[model samples]
Target: MRKFIILSAFAATLFVSCDDTRKVLHEQYLEYVMHTDSLDVVHDAMTVHHDALKTDTRTLAQKLKDVEETDSIAIADLAKHQVLLKEQATSLSKLKKLIESHADVKSYFMSDSISVEQMEAQLVEMEANNTDIAARLTQIKTELKMIEAEQESLKKTEKH
Candidate 1:
């Protein structure tokens, strides 16, 4: 009878230990997945913002050239170009600030103690803002081209 009791107790202890071990392993796996996701978000955000800044800078330079070359430019038209220039400058400044912030995020993400949830949230918001800025840059380029076309039309009318 004593032998039977000892056998049952040994089996119960083994079962409990196994369950505990499984729980710990599952929790660790989840933590690893979340950490990896956060790192991916930060990396993707940085790449997209870098590409956008490069393209926007090129577009702004071309617009500036057009503004400078405009002949017999009306004061109102010049004012419009100046406003667009100011807007482009502001966008460029914002992009520069984002580049600086990206470095900080990268450093923070490297630490295990940092909150992955908050980092992901911030990265998502930053990506949305960057996309908006890129769209605005495209719109500005289209408007600048329209202005150039109008100036050319005026010149041709004057020639005739």
Candidate 2:
């Protein structure tokens, strides 16, 4: 009958609609997984960089403490610089902790109902921050090496 045909057509349309919806959701889920993986990779790299900076700061501090010429103005300047480096290192540590506390990036995105574009924006921001930190760390390390070389030169002059 005409009624029977119409009813069957309606059922088929609903079924197709449900299938399409599911396909869209599955694609979205895959994209989310990829984003989560990218975030994890970036976070891990940041953590490693942070740890290296902390270690370098500690070593430099120890060397400063061991320097024998406390009265030298150069040594004083180096000590001041070392203090600043320590402060920066402490700030970095706090940042690392904060990031770790929000390690579940996927949950954060889901809980806030953030769109994929927003998540990508955040990821880019994180990458930029990491790059900035890395540049700063490199600069600090170079300064520390120069200071060490100067200290050695001073020691040689004093021996003469």
Candidate 3:
């Protein structure tokens, strides 16, 4: 009877050890799945943003052909559109980096909102780049309008 009890205890210990390993493996599987899903979402968002940026860039190119400095109205509108494009591009880049860096997902997530610190830092840098791009774009648009106005006035004088 004493030997039987000792054997039972040993068997229970082995079972517990196996259970712990299985749990760890399960958690790793779950993490991989979750990470993949998050990356998919990021990729989709990036694609959409990329498309939008292409459209905005095309619009700016077309606008440059027709908008003059004299037409302050169109100039301001184009600047605003450019700013929006810059913002979208920044957001797409940040999400892409985040997805790429997050190879591991914790099983005990206190909040679904948790994120990797390095990824977040990359995102912040992207945002700063966007801000600078926006400012530069605004300046260029202002200069473009001035040149357009001068050209329009020259054309007007020639017509006279």
Candidate 4:
């Protein structure tokens, strides 16, 4: 009887702490995942438009390693990730097409011999793409901040 009572007390203490502690870790992981997602298009749109990025390749590729189910702790922040995933993927495809279309421009830049007309055309294309990419990044960043704040709050509560 005494052993049973001791075990019960121990279990109770463990339950309360573990419940919230787990929530904290889960929330941290969720934000990590969300930020990882927001970076995909942001990075692609900016300084990292390499060949691999043309396909399903970005920093978030790791966070999105598996997505069969979003309810798990691994993907708790699934909805945002899903939306960003599709939008970023679409953006990436469009960006790749834009870049591919400007193959001549890239070659010209590399070759150091381009006509003024070609430069103007490339400039226009870049301006349009830059605007679109900026807008998408703004949206993703806003969503990411919101989720990050929520995760922070959850962590603080868990600490107590």
- TM-scores for every candidate against the unseen true structure: 0.45, 0.45, 0.40, 0.37
Q: Lowest summed lDDT over 10 consecutive residues: which window, candidate 1?
A: 25-34
Off by over 4 Å in 1: 1-73, 154-160
lDDT of all the models against the reference? 0.54, 0.56, 0.51, 0.49
- 2 or 3: which has the higher TM-score? 2
- Estimate, for each residue in 1-160, the C-alpha lDDT of model 1 and write its tens digit: 8999999999999888865654554454345445445544543554454345445444544554466553444434545655655665565566555545545555455444444455556556556655555565556556556655654554454344
Q: Give the per-residue Cα lDDT of candidate 3 at 27.
A: 57
Displacement of the residue 127 alpha carbon in candidate 2, Å: 2.2
User: For each candidate, how many residue pairs have backbone atoms clashing (under 3 Å)?
Assistant: 0, 0, 5, 0
lDDT winner between candidates 2 and 3 = 2
Which lDDT tens digits does candidate 3 get at residues 38-85? 555645754564565457445554656554443555455556656655
Q: List the residue pairs that clash in candidate 3.
A: 69-145, 69-146, 69-148, 69-149, 70-149
Query: Which ten residues in a row are the worst by lDDT in model 3?
Result: 103-112
Q: After superposition, how far is residue 142 of candidate 4 from its true place, in Å?
A: 1.1
Model 2 root-mean-square deviation: 7.2
Give the higher-TM-score candidate: 1 or 3.
1
